[model samples]
Target: MRTEFNWHLTAWKSLGRPSPGDIIWETELLNHSELVMRKRAYQNSTLYATFPRDPCDSYVHCGGNGNSVLNSSLICQCLKRFVPGSLENWNLKDFLKGCVRRKPFSCRNDGFAKYLQLKLLDTTHNWINKSKNLVECMAKCLSNCSCSAYTDIDVRGRGSSSAIWFE
Candidate 1:
């Protein structure tokens, strides 16, 4: 018997347990929806791995205000309504400095974009409003000129948590 866990599963019944192997095999999907399997490691001597989880799992892997989309050729991409800071870098595979707003926020005419299936970013520059509902949280975030994004994060027992980020 092998204990295998899959980190990404779109549905429950669709789940398939990985087989136990001293040699680990992992798949990394590229931009064109092509799947490439790479031998990650041998579970001998020590068991450990590296960061970014994969090339696509790094914070701002696509640069500032940019997102690293999984299974895409241009993994790092500016969020909706934004443009890359350096188009040359973006095309040349250098995603260090992420993105810039397409239109400057008047603060009065700005709206929030909804995103799904993402890992929580680092909370170093976040503001937590525990009591606010999603609408209230959006309003709270809207008042601050620096608030770049907001979300209602669920906290199992404690309920939903309002998290806002300043890019």
Candidate 2:
């Protein structure tokens, strides 16, 4: 008489937040029987075998709080993909150079056009428009070499002020 031995595979399961820098490589198997096999690896060369985990039981968290600087950094990365020479450390001088290169007569009355409205810190304002004469304003700055950057004045909300600056 011959006896047959049955070998049962161990079912893998996971619950909880994924470790930092853990990347899922592949999902080899999944079934309605609540059995699954997932291959994952961490940044530090550690391997993990994960299985079906309860979605409600696991907490997916994103790193880093949303801040202006962080947001700017992300935007810079996006810009780099399109504009190869664009730098994240753009200062007033760099910005002015770029503007001049793109539109040399931007400072002239016919050069600068209405860009758009920008709302910041709960204040709403049109960045450029005809009433304030954006073209003339920019033209004046261009005439004076000392001006590096120019921003429109706030017209809406609590503190409305029209102003220009040079550096």
TM, every model = 0.64, 0.24
The alpha-carbon RMSD values of the candidates against the true structure, listed in the order shown, are: 9.6, 21.1
Note the Cα lDDT for every prediction shown. Answer: 0.66, 0.32
TM-score of 2: 0.24
How many clashing residue pairs appear in each of the predictions shown?
4, 2
After superposition on all CA atoms, how large is the RMSD of candidate 1? Answer: 9.6
Which 10 consecutive positions of candidate 2 have the poorest summed lDDT? 59-68
Query: Worst lDDT window (10 residues) for model 1?
Result: 30-39
Error of 2 at 52 (Å): 39
lDDT of 1 by residue, 1-167 (tens): 11353332122222384454333333333321222223334433332343345767655566667777778877877878889898888889898877888998777787787777666666768878777767788878888888888888765645457888985
lDDT of 1: 0.66
